[model samples]
Target: MSTLSTSLFYGGLGILVVGLLLPGWDTATLPRRAVKRRIYWGATLVALPVLFAAGWPDVQSSLAFTAMACVLMGGWAYFRTPNIKVGGRIITADPSHREPDPTPRGGGRP
Candidate 1:
């Protein structure tokens, strides 16, 4: 249990780092960047506390409260962030849809 929790904690930590670093990335456009930011940050918010709880059982109760707080806050922010367009696709709360085809129209398979 400890080993698994430790691994998860590190994984969540990596996600948090990626979330923190995304704003510095320059290539993504505004909409794509915003969507990515929300995703990584939201995941970090929800994952970190759970991992921490597992890794530190002595503080599990406190971490559980922290996790609930994170869930409420993260969920609110996740839904509140406005949808954005990346190329032709509108990225909404559900981003699982297929990405916009990157090829310029009338340019892909001729």
Candidate 2:
């Protein structure tokens, strides 16, 4: 890879890694960000892969990008979806069933 392509690839990777490694990146445990925000991230990350795929030789370069896409999409999904999703739809606004429950539940007590 030429210096330019190398820089671009690493730059993209760095951007993705920084975004993913943020304090709350443990997607399974994170609260949903705004759907619009997720859309932006999803579009962005997905686009990056295509861009990188064009410049790089590996197909796996897109994996992280796709994973991030999933995370953002997931956030979008959970935005209004209460936790404990039953069947295939959101049925409750119980608040407690939501993610990142604002008030931390006491361990195995609450």
Q: Which candidate is the best by lDDT?
A: 1
Residue-wise lDDT of candidate 2 within 1-110, one digit each (tens)?
56765676566655554444433311333334332234445445655754455365555654554565566545644553343244534434455444433322222210
Q: Each model's RMSD to truth, in Å?
A: 8.6, 10.2
lDDT of 1 at 32: 45
Error of 1 at 70 (Å): 5.8
CA lDDT, candidate 1, residue 41: 61
Relative to the true structure, candidate 2 reaches a TM of 0.34
RMSD of 1: 8.6
Q: Residue 52 lDDT in model 2?
A: 58
Superposed Cα RMSD, model 2: 10.2
Predicted structure 2: lDDT: 0.47
TM-score of each: 0.37, 0.34
Mind giving the per-residue lDDT tens digits that candidate 1 earns over 4-107?
Answer: 66676667656655654555222333344445656666666666665566557667644764575467445644454332445655455655533452333334
